[model samples]
Target chain A: MKQWYRDTGLQARMFLTMFLLAAVYLAFISFLATTGVGTMGIVVVAGIFIFIQYFYSDKLVLWSMGGKIVSESEEPELHTIISRLCQIADLPKPRIAVVENNVPNAFATGRSKKNAVVAVTTGLMHQLNHGELEAVIAHELSHVKNRDMLVITIASFISTIAFFLARNLMFFGMMGRGRRDSGGIMAVWIVSILVWLVSFLLIRALSRYREFSADRGSAAITGQPAQLASALMKISGTMKRVPTDDLRKVEGMNAFFIIPAVSGSSLMKLFSTHPQIEQRIAKLEEMQQKMEF
Target chain B: MGFLDAFLGKTKLPKSKTKDIFAISTANVTFEVNLNLRALNKAGICFKPQASSHFTQARAEVEELLAYSCKDTNTGYQITKDAYGYTWIVLEDPDFEDLVSNIYLVSEGLIERDFGEQLLCALFTFKEKGGANVYWIYNFKHGNFYPFAPKANKERNSAFEFRLRSVMEKELPIEKDVERWYPLWDVPV
Candidate 1:
């Protein structure tokens, strides 16, 4: 099979992030065991949380975004583009949905490739050209192909436990009257907080790297990195003029969107779910340059 | 995709799978004898064009090579772009074998130039006794064939398409998932 452009830097960074995440999680679990905090309770809670999330994520995401699943007869152009991309990517056709907002964004969500759904906002359909729209949908399909939903869900397992422990441990510490066990509870609370904070950063980093990987996948599938680059630019450009109220409604979904809804804060790069738009476009331009050769 | 690739967030596009396209030529007899469908002796290979100078130059050379080689086979061909921004290399020949081989040539030429991902599908036209148009679409990416019967106003005759699939499934590499049976509206074959 012919290979597209490669990015060792991104791959290495992703590897390093996963390694650190695993290390952090292992240490957190060990700490919980030593502190005599019932790890089973946290694990069961986290498991239930993830199970619900994994199974119903598509429905929840679409409903939250006000998306409507459109039949092929309703959105023939959209369906055709998705069909071609899916065929090229060697994926099962995913359900196509359209959101009514004019936010110029799109997302993909499902537990597995077979049950995935790719959605676009009406504002996005009106904003981009045919090539740009295809490019954006290709990016979303890449997310599905790479199992971003599953990866992110599993990666956050420890974080979810740590968060739950952190909040409840503090409350338990406050209620206890004795200093002997109080000290142990305090130690566990501090450890849980540390684990949660560290894992939070690592998860965000992992998510951003996944975005870069998905961008590369989009380029590989469509053979048009420039089109995706332009789509990102156009989406972000229009995102600026969109009403803040409109953006606020969908801000919680920034992690899954092609471009984060809120812009203009460079300091938020580390915490943001997606990489900076400029950086993403630069990577895509690099692919475009390599393809020219 | 392999487990390792998914774990590493790698999604390389599948290689062009045009080898199974020849199954259509062999199945042509089944269509004529059993289904009352006659070959129109016309096929179109559709591909997406990259916005790169390299692709444009490679395409020019490929077209020149195509024209040079088709002279002996007497296969008529023309290049056209559709409203959806896909390019089509339409081939015409009375012999079904020639039409099929020419479609392969176009796909092979592009794949050799490292643009296999750009190759979409090839449409082979067939006509019924009632003058309705039926097409056997060979998806190059997935290497599966599907039936597309278009009625007026861009409506599809699903019943006829399903009938074609039933008859041709044994002879051709028919696409099993009907969802991948994408309709190519305004196909200029």
Candidate 2:
């Protein structure tokens, strides 16, 4: 049973990242209290926004992708693949939606396992053969199984709050009345910015870690990591050839996609919601090797 | 899934509970005595047949086993591919117990061969006094039973299904989440 899914290094990094995020969040909140910043209004506003976004995230994602939920009759092959994977993964069947795009990507969204929706682009179906497509769909199902939507939403909550505080503090710092007051406001503003920056990077790192974990899940479910690796390679290879206009249209959903629409540059890599395709494929290949042995 | 497990994306494949299907065999007595529902002498195991050669080999082994076992019980079985791309192993026998055990045998056979996850659900057909079809679907993964009474025009008789649930909830492991009571439209049983 303990064949290949365990990754001690990955787990350690994920735990450390989460621990650092929590520490940053706590320090920021305490700093706000010490400065008497009156965060009740901000907390309430952010709470309401995140709540709605979390609750309706599946619908929001589907709408943004222009995905239409397809019935079994419409896409029996897709449904069959998803249902079979769901059975293997011990997950309830999630609603399957199809987007009429030539982007060759897929994503899973929902607040919880029961409410999840998995959407794949038309191009993915047209491009991948049976095993490759099943591998990709299994990867999306892993996101649903791991509850990536809920985890990412909760992790980003503090980043959002810190961002809001930083922006509002910036305006207040500019309009200060006295030197001493301005100095105090300046210190708080810097702390908020620092908190925001740290949380944002941590969140990105956490998202990348979740991606690796989901890949492992796909490996576990399908028992074929090499297929998923091949699928990822094909999608990434196809992504480069897709029109820039098409990539730009779906770029906003990079975090949820099987492969981000854009890649390159170390600076962009640091902020990327998904790990680089080469790195992901490498890990999957390693898993495949372990399973084979 | 635990909090830490979810955080780590660790999951175990759920074990198939083909054994729990025996509950339906005993519950048939209650159905006949009180609900005026009679077993249609037909039950089938619907599964998504894999395209791989190994699955074909496993299924062939299951067929060979079924053929060998049915010879002794006088139970008749047929394998038919449905329009919806699912393979149904339909079993017929005057003895309802034989029908139940045969369905169980086929599922167990596949499971033992490591193709158990491909078995979708086991469906047993029953009829009401007026010739209306009522169905009991046993989800292999979940190990729960759900009533599916299909009406004409692609509709379900939820009221009647609910009554069946309420009545048999004590004797059978009925699936509580109605959302998971997926309808098997045009089931070839």
lDDT of 2 at A194: 88
Which window of 10 residues has the lowest lDDT sum in candidate 2 chain B?
B47-56
For model 2, chain A alone compared with the true chain A gives a TM-score of 0.86
TM-score of chain B of each: 0.95, 0.94
Chain B of candidate 2 achieves a TM-score of 0.94
Between which residue pairs do clashes occur in model 2? none
Error of 1 at A228 (Å): 1.6
* Leading candidate by DockQ: 1
DockQ metric, candidate 1: 0.64
**Model 1 spans > 4 angstroms off:** A1-4, A172-180, A238-267
CA lDDT of each candidate? 0.86, 0.83
Which regions of candidate 2 deviate over 4 angstroms? A6-8, A35-44, A69-96, A129-134, A176-178, A222-227, A238-268, A285-293, B33-40, B46-68, B71-93, B106-119, B127-133, B151-160, B186-188
DockQ scores for all the models shown?
0.64, 0.31
